[model samples]
Target: MGTFVNNAWYVAAWGNEVRRELLPRTLLGQQILLYRKENGEAVALVDRCPHKLAPLSLGELKGDSVQCGYHGLTFDCSGTCIRVPGQRNIPTEAQVRAFPVMEKYNAIWVWMGDPEQADTTAIIDVPHYGDPGWGLVDGQYLHFKSNYLNITDNLVDPAHTSYVHKNTIGNAAGEEVGVKVEQSDSHVLAYRWINDAPQVPLVERMGKLAGNVDRWQYYYLHLPSISYVDFGCIPVGTEPTEANKDRGFRSFSFNFLTPETESTTHYFWLHLRNYHPDDPQASDDVARLMNQTFEEDATLLEFIQREQERTGVREYARIAIDNAPLRIRRQIERLQSKEQSAEAAAMDCEAETAIR
Candidate 1:
C-alpha cells in the first residue's frame, strides 16, 4: 500500500526527542519504542512485546533495556531478550526485531525494510551544513494525512505559491516573473529572473537593485521517499561598478516523508545554511517562519487527500506543473520493478543450486 522499498532511510524524529525514557512513536503504521542508553546511544525496537502484544513503551526503562510491564520481559537496545523474570531458562527464540538506526544533522533515521539491504551509503548529502561561513538553523517535524507523492508534487511547482501561499511567501510579482525549467535524471531545476520588481508582503526582500535579480529554485525527488528544495537570491546592484554590493542570500531545505500507512505520512525537515547554526535568536526566527509555511502546506494537503478518498477517483487530470511529481512516480515504479525481477532471479538460481 505504501512505497517503502528495502533500502531507504526514514526520519524517525529529532535527536532531542528521544531521551532516557522510552517513547512510543508510530512510523509506517508500525508502533515503535525509542530511547537512549546510559552512554547516550539511541536505539529503536518494535514496540509490541512478543509474549503478550503489550506496548513496550508503557513498560519501564532500565539502564540499557526496556522491561515490558505485563510480564517483566526485558529487551536490550538491540532487541535481544536480556532477562525473563521468574524463569530458569530463556528460550533462544525469544527476541524482538531491532531496526538499524543512526543520528545525523540532529535527526534520527530508521531502516524499516530488509536489514541486509540497509546501508549508510543511502544517506543524503547536505553540502551547506557545517560549512564554517554559512549559518545553520534548527528544523521541526510535521505530520500529514496526505499521500507522500502529493507533497513531492507540491514542492516542484513554485507557481502554486502565488495562489496557495498568497498570504505567506507568495508575492504578486512572483506570478508575473518568467521561469525557465530544466530536467535531469533525478531532479528538475527552475530559475526565475526578475527585474526591478516591487517588494510585496510576506516575501523576504533583498532590497531594490538596478539590474536583474536571479532567483534559483531546484527540486530533487530522491528514490523511495525523500525530497529537497534549494532556493536563493543573487542580486545585481544598481551601479555599473560592483564595488559596494552586498552578497546575496542562499538556503536549502529537505523533506523526508516516511509513509506511516497508505494514507498517512510523517514529514521530517531540516533548514540549513553555511552561517546560522549557533545564532539562537536568528535560528528561532527562521524556525518560526519555516513552521508557518509547513502548516499551510499540511492543512491543504490533508484536505485534498480526504476529498480524493471520498470521491474514489482513479485518474485525476494534471497540469504542466505536475511534471516533477509524474517523473518521481515513474522512478519509484522502475525501482520497484527492478527489485522484483532481482528477487525472482535469485529464487531461480537457488532452485538450480539445490538440484545440483
Candidate 2:
C-alpha cells in the first residue's frame, strides 16, 4: 500500500513486450532494463551501468548481453560484466544487480527484493488460462496516474461501479446490493449478488438473457496488488451453485497492478470468458468495452489522486462498503511489517556472526 511490497512478484511486462531489443521500465521506484535472450528467456537488470552510472537502456544488445552506448563495457543477462574494452582487469563491483524474472500466463513477472527469496511458485494463478472453452484477451496495459493502493481500493470496492462505469459494466440496479466479505491468509474477497435484475449493458449485448437474471460480482484482491473479478450471470430462479454458475455466462477478469512510483501505477490486465471462445468479433468488442471502462476509472482516479495530494488526506469517512478495501490495507501493512521484521532479524544475525 505504501509505495510497494518489494518482496512480492510484480508483473514487469507482457510476454510480447520484452524482446531482443533493450526495453526500460520503472518498477517500485527502480529503473530496470528488460530483454529476452536468444533462447526466449526474459531477463531483468538494474538499468544503470556500474562503470559510469550510464543507463543500460541506452546501450545496444549484443547476443544476450547489453553494451553501454558510451563506453564499450558489456553486461550479460546475469548482470555480470563479461567484457570491458581497453581493460585487462574488471573491477569486482563492475556488475549490476539482476532480478529474478519468469514468464507465466503470458505475462513477465519480476522480483524486486532479496533474490534468494524469489520463489516462482508464489505467482498468482490464472485458472482459465490456456483452457479450451475460454476466450482470452491479454497483453493489455494502462498507466494510472494514481497510487497502486488507491487503484486496489477501487478494485475491491464494488459500489463504485454503479456510478463510475454506468456506460460500460455498471447500472443503477446494483446501487444498493449488499456485499459479503471474506479473507484468507493471502487474499480478500468481497462479493455480491443482484437477483431478479436486468443485465448490465455489456452483458445484455453479449449474452442471450431473457427478462431478468441473477448476476454476481466477486472482487478478489490477491495479496499485495493482483485483482480478479469472478463475474457472471444466470437466468432468474436458477440455483446459485458453482456448477450452474460455470455453465452460465461467466468471466475471469484480472488486473495486475505494478507500482511505478508512489504517485503512479502500471495496470496490466487480461480477461477470460466462457462464452464466445472462438468469436473474434466478440473478443474485439470485449476489448473495446473493457478498455473504455478502465479509461473511465483512470481519469477519475487521476483527479482523485491530485486532490488527495493537495489535501494530504486519503479519505474523510468510511462506510460499510469499505470492508474489503480496509481489509486489504491491513493485510498489506501486515506483510510489510513482517518483511521488515525479517530483514532486521537477518541483519542482527549477520552482525552477531561478524562480531564472533
Candidate 3:
C-alpha cells in the first residue's frame, strides 16, 4: 500500500463506469467500492468491512446500502453501519471511512484526503466540457508502472513527442523552434512555436490541412492534476507571426491526469474542436482516427514504464525543450513545502490550545 498525500483529488473512474452495482477501485493504494444509490447518487466507501475486514465490493448492494458478504453486515454510503443480521442493534462503533465523490465532465472524482477539506474548489476547471459548438471525443484510461511524477514530466515535455511519437505526431526534421515558458504560484504554461515546414506524412496525408502553416502549441499545467494543450494553425496566406493574435486556432484538448498510486495513473481527456468533415460518416471516421493516435501514445508510455522499472534508475538528463517538465517539478516541490509548513503550524496551534 502507498501513502496518500492529503488534500488532493484523484479521478476514480469514468462516471458511466459506476452504476447500481458495486464497482471496486484502488486510489492512492486504498481499496474502495463505488456505486450509485436508488436515486442515482454516486457514493464511495472503504472496501473493507468493519467486522471481519472482508472486501465490501464482493458484497451485494441493497437499496442505498451495501451488505458485507462475510457476515451480512450492512453499511450506508456514509460508512455508517446500518445493520448486522441477527444482532439486536447495530453497534455504534461499527463504521468504515467514506470519501467525498462527485461526477464532473463524465468522470468520477474522489477526494482521497481529509474529508473536512474536500470541496468543489479542489477540482480543476474544464471550460470546454459544456460548450456545444465543439465536437467532443472520449479519451483513454491507461495504467503505468512508473511514478505519477514521471507521467507529469512526460506531458510537460513537448520535445519527446518528436522522437517518441515520430511515426505519429513527431516532426523528425522540423526545426527546434523557440519556446516561451512561464510559471506562477498556481500554474505553468509552455508555448512552442513551430516554424514553416513541409507537413510530415501523417499530417500531410491525414490532417487534410494544406499550404504553408506554422503551429503554435501551448500547454497549461493548472496545479495538482490538470493540463491542457491549445493548438493554433495559420494558413499559408495568413500572417504566420500574427496568427496567434488573430485567434487562428480552432481546436483544444484537456487532459486530467490523476494518480491512483505512486506507480499508476488515470488519464481522462476531452478533445474539443469545431473542425469536422461535412459527411457524418467521415466525421466519425476522423474521430476514430484521432482516437487511434492517442492509443499509440498510451502504448508507448506503458512500454516506457516497464523499461524504467527494469533499469531501476531515476532522473533522466533533460534537453532545452524540457523546460515544461522542469517548471512543473519546481511547482510540485513548492506545493509540498507549503503543505508541510501548514501542518507544522497546525501542530503548534494544537499544542498551545491544549496548554490553555
Judging by TM-score against the true structure, name the best candidate: 2
Tens digit per residue, CA lDDT, model 1, 1-356? 34546557788888999999988888777898889889988899999988889999989998899999999999988888988999878888779989999899888889877688888777888866777666666557888888887777777777777677665556566776554556565455544544455433322532323334444456666667777766554554344222222235456778888887777888888776432446776567667777788889989988888988899872478766666667777777776677778888989999999999
Tell me the number of clashing residue pairs for each predicted model.
Answer: 9, 0, 1
Q: Which stretches of candidate 3 lie over 4 Å from their true place?
A: 1-5, 173-175, 200-208, 237-249, 277-291, 303-312, 340-356
The positional error of residue 300 in candidate 3, measured at the CA in angstroms, is 4.2
| Candidate 3 per-residue lDDT over residues 1-356, each given as its tens digit | 23235577777888789899999987767898999999988999999998889999999999999999999999988999989899878787799999998888888888877688888886877655656555566544656555666667666666666666665455754446666788887788877767675554445544546765676667787777677777656665566554443345345667777777676776777666555523465446545655565566667666777777778665467678777777777777776777778888989999999999
Residue 329 accuracy (lDDT) in model 3? 75
Model 2, span 60-133: residue lDDT tens:
99999999998989999898999999978899999999999978989999999889999999998897799998
Off by over 4 Å in 2: none
For each candidate, give its TM-score against the true structure: 0.85, 0.97, 0.85
Largest lDDT belongs to which candidate?
Answer: 2
Q: Judging by lDDT, tell me the better candidate of 1 and 2.
A: 2
In model 2, pairs of residues that clash are none
Clashing pairs in 1: 28-260, 29-260, 134-274, 134-275, 135-274, 135-275, 135-276, 136-276, 136-277
Candidate no. 3 TM-score: 0.85
Worst window of 10 by summed lDDT in candidate 1: 237-246
